[model samples]
Target: MRRRAGVGAIQKHRLEQEKYKEKGTEIQENQFQQMSKQLEVFRENLEDFASKHKSEIRAENALNHMVREGLAWVDSQEPKETLYWFPSMFAECVSA
Candidate 1:
């Protein structure tokens, strides 16, 4: 009878540990889902801001002018970065 009681206690302890592990995994999954949603929202907001201020953003950055000029010469290749350009050259050429 004593041996049977000891075995039962061990089984109960194991079951409790498994339940705790399952609960922890569920909590982690929920947190990951919430973070993923927030990241998507941030991406959408950034895209919207870029569209609304497209001219200002392009005018403010000199690199955009260079990229725009480079893109015009390329016929087959696609640029890896976003392209922004003003109608005329905004940066002066500096010979080094």
Candidate 2:
């Protein structure tokens, strides 16, 4: 009887571990999707900016520099580690 209980406890522990793993995977997938959507928005905005300022090399250079700086700052941030919030940072540049 003791042996049977021990085996059952191990099985239960394994099942709990599996559940935790599944939850972790779901969270990671959600984060990935959010990041992808953010990237698409950023790309569309950049393209719009480029179109609007096609003849101005300085504008393009400034935009590129802002993007690089934003990306570097995002990289330094430990929480996200990527420029998923680029549009907000880009807006700061535009306003400046």
lDDT of each: 0.73, 0.78
TM-score of each model, paired residue for residue: 0.55, 0.53
Index of the highest-lDDT prediction: 2
lDDT of candidate 2 over 1-96, digit per residue (tens)? 344568888999999999999999999999999999999999999999988888797755665687788642334466754333456758789999
State candidate 2's TM-score.
0.53
Question: RMSD of each candidate?
Answer: 10.2, 16.0
Looking at model 1, which ten-residue stretch has the lowest summed lDDT? 87-96
- On the 0 to 100 scale, the lDDT of residue 67 in model 2 is 70
Candidate 2 Cα errors over 4 Å, as ranges:
1-5, 58-96
Q: lDDT tens digits, residues 32-74, model 1?
A: 9999999999999999999999989986565545566673222
- Give model 2 RMSD, 1 decimal: 16.0
- In model 1, the Cα lDDT at residue 94 comes to 40
